[model samples]
Target: MITERKIDLTGLKCPMPIVQLAKLIKELDAGEEFTATADDPAFCLDVESWCNKTGHELIRLEDSNERLVAVIRKKISEVE
Candidate 1:
């Protein structure tokens, strides 16, 4: 079964949101999904880049109400 998780980074600034995301990702198992929500304008770009660099799958990204949400699936190879 796939596990789902959530991390709220709203109101946080650059680097911190990404930093916290990195930490959260590290604790997840392969095939799990996590949604990270943030208010930082740069979160979308930063997270897209981060996911690309780290080999995570960017499942979906939603931008609305001055908030940014990224749903990511943990890559099987990256779980270690």
Candidate 2:
């Protein structure tokens, strides 16, 4: 079963939003998903890059009003 979560980073700036996201993602089980909302103008690009680098799926990204919303799915862990 996949679990969904949401995080609000609207008032944060720069790396704080990404930092908080990373922290939350750590707590989620593999295949779980989350939606994050932020007001920082750089959030869109930052989220895209973060997902790519972290191997998570960036399912959707869009702007609503003045806020940026991102949907992401956690990647399954690989055994080394």
Candidate 3:
């Protein structure tokens, strides 16, 4: 069984995937895991860099199997 929060950006372009991801990230609580699938070829590297720059943890990056799917986990930060 596939147990993960899936965000599909299969028909999106560059920047859109990241935009969508950013929106989702903001709504995600700490310790939540999100898997995003994007058709944008540059998204693989873009999101990776974005994650690194933003301090979000990237669990895995599978870019060339069947689609561009990035596994990301939120950091521990208590929200008010």
Candidate 4:
């Protein structure tokens, strides 16, 4: 079974949101998906770059209300 996780980092400044998101991603099992919300203007770019660099899949990312919402899927292997 797959479990969904959530990380809300709204109102946080740059880097903190991405830092926390990365930490949460590390704790998840392969195939697990998580939803993260952040209001930092740089979150969208930071997250996209991070995911691309780390191999995690960015399932969805969008702006809603005053926040940036992201849905990410953990990669099965770190080296893959």
Using TM-score, give the best candidate's number. 1
Pitting candidate 3 against candidate 4, the one with the higher TM-score is 4
Per-residue lDDT tens digits for candidate 1, residues 1-80, read 66568999998998899899889988999878999999999998999999989999999999998899999998988444
Candidate 2 residue pairs in backbone clash: none
lDDT of 2 by residue, 6-57 (tens): 9999999999999998999999998899999999998989999999888999
TM per model?
0.91, 0.91, 0.84, 0.91
Candidate 4, residue 68: the lDDT equals: 93
Position 21, candidate 4: lDDT: 78
- The regions of model 4 sitting more than 4 angstroms off are none
As for candidate 1, its clashing pairs are none
Where does model 1 exceed 4 Å of error?
none
Comparing 2 and 4 on lDDT, the stronger one: 2
- Once superposed on the true structure, which residue ranges of model 2 sit more than 4 Å away at CA? 78-80
Residue 41 of candidate 4: its Cα lDDT?
A: 87
| lDDT of candidate 4 at residue 57, scale 0 to 100 | 94
Sort all candidates by lDDT, best to worst: 2, 1, 4, 3
For candidate 4, write residues 1-80 as lDDT tens digits.
77778999988998788789778887899989999989888898988999998899999999877689999999988793
User: Ten residues in a row with the worst lDDT in model 1?
Assistant: 71-80
The residue-by-residue lDDT of candidate 3 on 1-80, one tens digit each, is: 33568899998987788888889988888778999888788888898898887778999999786588889988777334
